[model samples]
Structure formats: C-alpha cells, structure tokens
Target: MTDTALVVGGTRFIGRHTVSDLLANGYDVGMLNRGNHENPFADDGRVTHIEGDRTDERDLRAAKLSTEPDVVIDCVAYHPRDVETAVDVFGDVDGYVYVSSGSSYAEEAIPKREGETPLRPCTPEQATDESGETYGNRKAEGDRVAFAAAEAGVNAMAVRPCVVYGPHDYTERLDYWIDRVLTHDRVVVPGDGQNLWHRAYVEDVASALRTVAERGEPGAAYNVGDRRALTLAETVETVAEAAGTECEAVPASADALAAGGLDPDDFPLYREYPHLLDTCALAALGWESTPVDEAMARTVADHRESDRDGNEWDPGRDAEERVLGVKETL
Candidate 1:
C-alpha cells in the first residue's frame, strides 16, 4: 500500500515531462534510467531517481522491488522483452501503466475513430527477444508484453501516443520547421505534401499517463492523440505566417537529400496521410493537450534560449526529410 510511482527514461523527452507533472500533482515519484543525460528536475526530495539501464536485469530487479511501488509507468521500452523483465522484477506491484506507440498498429490501416482501434499484431515469443528493434514491429511486440503482463496479475493499462512535441523537445522536429520558417527560408516537403500528421504535446501526454496509472481501465489500450490535425504543407505555411515571415517549400530533391545527409536511396521518407486519434478513449482520464499557439511559443522560446539541450529525440526525427526512404548507394 505504498504510495509511490516509478518512471523509466525519467530524464528525457516525455519521461522528463511526466516526472515534473507527477511532482506538481503531489505524487511521490521515483525515476529510473541509465543517467546518460542531463537531469531535468531540481532536487525536490519528493522525487527519487534511480539510475540504471532498462535492458539490464540487475536494474530491473532493483527498479521493481526497491520501490515497492503502487504504480509503475514505463516510458523507455521499445521492445517487448523489456516489458517481460519489468513484470518479472515487480513481483506483486499493484498498478502498471506502459507507454506504447500508436505505431503499434499498422501505419496503413488504423481507423480514426473514438470507440475502438484495431491493434497491430505481435508474437508472444518476440515479446522477450533481446535483439529485435524496429519502431512499429517492436512496439507491437512491446504491446503484447504490457497487455499480457497486465492480464497476469496487475492493474495494467497501455497508452499509445503519436508525434509528441513541446518545449524541452529533444529532436526539435517541430523546431526544424519553425527554424526554417523563422529564417524566411523554404522548408522542404517530400511530395505533394498533403500528408496529415497527428500531434500531441508532451505535458499533456504526461498528464494522460498519470491519469492512466490512477484511473485507466485495466487490460485496455488508449490512443492519446488530438483532434487537431496538420498536414506538412499546412503546418509549414501556418508556421511561416505565425512567425511573421514569408517562406516556401520545395519538393525534396535527390541532390538536396544527399546534401542534407541522406543517401537519397535507402532512408526514404514514407509518411502516410495521418488520421486524428480517438482521444475519447482518454477523455475519461481527464487528459488534454496544451493550446497550439502557446505550445509553439514556448517551444520557440526554449530553442531560442537553448534550455532544451538534454531533450530526447530519435535518430533523425528532426530532419524534415525522414520517412522519404533515401536509398543507400550500392
């Protein structure tokens, strides 16, 4: 009956923001990570941080049993194996919340609805594989782990978030667009540039997570995304307008791709037209996104002031040209 929560990847991106929100909300918080990045929070003493790798068995044993937590929210899992390790270690914890990705569903066929969603497939065996890693496929595996582990004995819930951004954002994917627009320079778009991208703010995501840990229905997965939708072109134009500047977007070119450090052959950008997530699934948890204008301004200010050096980002999440599939040179 201890009132405590453990968060993995508590110093980076979504994890860091979730920790801050948890502290503000008066929950006893413990953060688990490898301590590879800068610490984002001041020592409030209410929050305890344990540094270690999620992939390490020693760390897992320590994370689950050391706290005897009331709830555990994992923020750093990419493979399902990581999930099994957590379940094994947290023998008899009360509540569990695993942050999964919406990409756990096939990019080509997720219905944009409120009542339910079709989950992508994953095998039980891969759920514990140490070497499997791909965004969508691995997430599918991780989902199985969280879902199955939740079914075994704990009050468990999974939250799937898409395209999270905000102040302290590490990759500055939004920053790339904002920077180019602020410079009054053309931002690059891959093709017809009409693909929609789902958006979620980091703090809002954290709030949803905390709520999920407390009130979310066990053995269920909720899509935590916003109704607000933006196509690549629309966002570029909107940002340019907001920045009080005029810029243009050109179709990405092979030479431009090569110059931007893409092979123009292997890592082709492949964005599907995105759909709005059915956040009604999360409405019961009292989740909400920050206002777009305010979020944008805050992000602009952070990057301008360099207050987000330690934010987490994927390999090329910042590059506007990712998903274009730049084929590797033979």
Candidate 2:
C-alpha cells in the first residue's frame, strides 16, 4: 500500500521541495497552507491542497488532519504552541518530522552536534512575541515540544537545519551574494570573511527530512547540513566562479560596516563566530548533502533563468557602496 503524507506550509522553499520529494517517492501528499502562495505541485493529481491557517485550532480541525496520515512534516512551526496544537490535533501518525533550525542551538560551540550542544530555551513571553528577534529561542522551545509529543506517543522527530540555500529562496539570503557577484565589480565582505558558515542545499534538506520521517528514531533530533564548512570568503568566491564573474572581496571590519551605516544583522552570512552544524547523525541515517560548488552553480543558474531582478538586495547594495567609498578614501 502507498503511504500518505501531509506537509504543513507546502507552498514555498523547503516545504515545496519536500512535497516534490514525497511525490517522487510515490507517496500521496496533502499540503496545508493559507492558499496565498502558488506552488508548482498544486497541479499534480496525487496531491491535495488544504487551505487553512495553522494557528487556528478550528482551521486545523476543519482540515481533518487527525485522520491519521502515514507521515506528517511540519515546515513552519515556530512556537511551542504550534507544536502543541499539531500534536493535539493530529493525535497520532506513523511518523512526524518538525523542521527546526540550527540557530536553536546555544552559542557555546563551533560545530553544533545533535546531542553535544544544549538547546536554548524561550520563555512564554518570548515565544508569543511578534518580533522575530527570538527566532532561535522559540525554535528550540518548539523542538522540545515536538519531542514531548513524541514521548506522549506521537512518533515525532525534529530536523534542525542550518542556513538553507537554493532556487526559489524568497528570503534572498544567498541571492544577495549571487546578485552581487553577477552584477558588481567588487563584493564588500564583513570582518575579513573567515568565519565558517554551514548551509544545505534545499533539495538535499528536503530529502533528509523525508529520510528522517521514514527511518529516523522517534523522539530524536537531527542536525542537517553539509559535512564540510566553508569560510565566507570562500563561499563568495565560489558564487563568483559559478556566475562566471570575478568580483573582488573587499574585507571590511565590523566597526567599518557600523561606521558606514550598515548593521551587522543586515548581512545574511556575517556572523562573528563560526555557525557550523554537525550532520553525522543524519548521514548515519543515509542522507548526503550536495557539494557547495555544485549547489552554487545550480542557484546561479536558477537566478539567471528566472525573473529575479526585482529581488535585489538594496540594503546590502547601499552598505557595499558605503564600505567601498570608505576604502577608496583610505
């Protein structure tokens, strides 16, 4: 018998990729979303779209999610309440995979492993806050809640991924670098560009989520990313190479960026410390990541073929110009 899977928030990014993976794997898929975004898979006959708000208990019940699907993958659960509601509403399933983030790990370690580094906790106030500043804390709390549901016989697991990059990335994090290298003569990188960064290909992350859903231990959390970490400068150079461009990396210190009216948070890959994730647990479960260079090539190609000109990073461009101006003076 074919398995049936439901993907919550299946209209974009990782959710879209996961839906494709499920379909390719021969499983009937159901998508739950607000019906605002357009997904390429909506036309597939084997896929069903359930229109509803995840936060509304009434909407979730209306979707009949408690009918006991073979697998359920939640790609947008940010708060503990979301997880609680999912478990309460879905009741029981063969497998449950919650898409968490590596940011949920504490800042103490360099390469965060699944069980080594402790997870940060969020208070009730922080969990419900509208501001996204508490994103990591809230994700950590949500991970705990998912595992708690697993303990209560929900057969759930959490997949914590680092920076995810590939085609159709609405966030424009990786696109910032791609557009810069393809269009500009020089790319201004913050803080010497030596901090190690970990990122996973969108499709690879989707496959890992499906793998965890099918074979991962219930009540466990897995860190998913490339086995190797690349420096920011190296990452930029790789993108430039993929785009067939040669943009010079203009290294600017944190103080210089601040002086140039650039907030450190504005740069997507600018972290003071290395943000690497250990993916051995997921690898042990038979998931492999796409190489960095190969992934960059695909991303650059996607941008070239798609209508991404409107997706320019204006703040990043302004900051780069300011830093370049200061460098010219020196």
Candidate 3:
C-alpha cells in the first residue's frame, strides 16, 4: 500500500515540507540527512531520523536497509552521479522520485512541457563541476539518469519545479519581495513588472513529490508549478495584500537601474522573458496548487514570525530611490 516513505535531505526547504506531506498522508516518514540542520520532526513519533550524507552511497544503502521504505523522495540529487547512485541503491523501491529544476529545460518557451521540451546537455566535466554556470546541465543529466534507471525497471521519475517559495525558503528570493512590501512604500521591480516567472508554493511542491511518488509513471518527467501564474506586478500586489498593506510597484527599466549602479539581475526573481511551465501533467495526477492569496498569506505570516528580512537580495533602498528618481525624470 506504499505506506512507508523516506526523504533524502529532508531537513530544509522543500524536503522538510515533503516530510510533513508524507506524514499527513498516513505514511511512516524517515528522513536521512547530514545532520547539518535540526530535524523539525525530531519529536514526532511518526518520523525517524537517520544521520547521513546524500553524497555517500553507503549512507543511502544503510538508510534503505534500516527503513525499507516503500517510496523515496530525493530532494538533494544535484549531480548526475548522485542520481545514478541513488537509483542503483533504491532500485527495488515502489517509487523513487527525484527533485529536478526548470533550469533543466534547454530552450525558452511560453510554457515548457515535459517530453516536448529538450533538456540541457551536460558533458562529464560539467556534470561534476559544482558551479552555478553548470547547474542546469547537471540537473538535466540527473533527470536523464533517473530516466535510464526507470528503463532498467526501477520505478524512478522526475519532477521539475521552476521556482519554489514559501515557509522556510532559504533562497530568500520571494522573501525579498515580502520584505519590500512590508518595509517600503515604493517597491522597485525590474522591467515593466509584467515579467512572468512560474513559481510553486513549497507545500504544493511537497504534495507534488508525494503525488508523484504514488501515481507518476516510471521514467516520466512532470512539471510542478502554480496552476494560475502571476506576473511580477501581480506578485507584488499579492504580497502586499498578504501583508495587509498598500505599496506602489515602481517599475524600473534596465537603464533606470543602471543609472543607480545596479543591474536588472540585482533584483531577485526578475526575468527578461516570461518563464512558465506547463503543469497539466502534474494536475493529471490529481494535484493542485494552493490559491495564490492563501499561499501568500501563509508565506507572509511565516515571514512575519521569522527573522528573514531577505536583505541579502536587497540592493539598498537608497539605490532604489535613485532608480525611482531616474524613472520620474523620464
């Protein structure tokens, strides 16, 4: 009945939510990690904690031996070799789901789809380089590895999430926007602020992992994202509403930002073109995203309760004010 689930790297972000999702769905959950982060479910009798590194195949094998999990959700397979090793160790499990990224898609399209969209190709050197430049290539290679494992009779599948945001988001991308809305009257958004970047709420992503583990076809890849996407302007509005505040979304062009010694890339979650993923495949599995407003509410509430101001993504309000001045003059 697929009653047992083991999450690899379940101490942070998406993985942490995945553990909760599995627990809520009546599966006995086990989390295997390097012990770098505290286990949020340590006291829960339904959860078991295994101290290990995902990079080590020995640790994976040991965890499997101890847990005998029916399904495994891997959230930290960053390299092709990592996926290869995991599939080899967990080949006999009922299901093995790998967390991939939208960056794996090689081409840009309005809505990138599974199977139709080509994935970034990785050379052996890029597969192990561990640099940001090769992240997509490496993830694409990992997706390929999972496909090959599925071909070899392993119930392995891949789920690609574009950008994930919610509670416990360490990336601080969306946090940047939430912080801006809470702390400022004028939020400087790059470009026209209609730039669309598909984002999945963390809980929806968690449910996707569980749903894929239960219902996904072997060797198939599915895209995970919000059913209803929002433009950057709409995103800011959503954040404002969530914070129960009013703010002006000041759209700053690249030239305006450059006038203030800032590049468009300095702003987090800014994309030149609309980045959307076709999530129909995931929806067919009977999964749905949390409503945008509801999702933002939980996210903002968590932000208010936490100390993450996301200042790391902020280029200082003074620089933004300079950009605003340039915009006003133009």
Query: Using lDDT as the measure, which candidate wins?
Result: 3
Candidate 3 has what TM-score?
A: 0.98
Model 2, C-alpha of 35: deviation from truth (Å):
0.1
RMSD of each: 5.9, 2.2, 1.0
Output the TM-score of candidate 1. 0.79
lDDT tens readout by residue for model 1, 101-191:
8777764444554224555666655554556355666776667777677778767778888788777777667776666566636546655
Cα lDDT tens digits for candidate 2, 1-330? 889988889888999999999989999888888989886875788888888898988877766553336888989887889988988777677788889999899765867888779999798899997677899999999889888888888888999989888888887777777777888888788888886778888989999999999999988999988766777888889888898889888888777787678855667777877888888899999898888788889989998886664344556577678888988887
* Candidate 2 residue pairs in backbone clash: none
Off by over 4 Å in 2: 64-68, 255-265, 309-313, 316-322, 325-330
Candidate 3 — worst ten consecutive residues by lDDT sum? Answer: 1-10
Location of the lowest summed lDDT over 10 successive residues in candidate 1: 261-270
TM-score of each: 0.79, 0.92, 0.98
Task: Please provide, for model 3 over 1-330, each residue's C-alpha lDDT reduced to its tens digit, 9 standing for 90 to 100.
Answer: 548899999988999999999988899988999899888898999888999889998999999988999999999999999999999999999999999999999999879999998999999899999799999999999999999999999999999999999999999889889988998888888898998989999999999999999999999999999888999999999999988999889888888899889888888898888899999999999999999899999999999998898889888888898998988898
- How far residue 179's Cα lies from its native spot in candidate 1, in Å, is 1.2
Q: Which candidate gets the maximum TM-score versus the true structure?
A: 3
Q: Which stretches of candidate 3 lie over 4 Å from their true place?
A: none
Q: What lDDT does the true structure give each of the candidates?
A: 0.69, 0.83, 0.93
* Pick by TM-score: 2 or 3, better one: 3
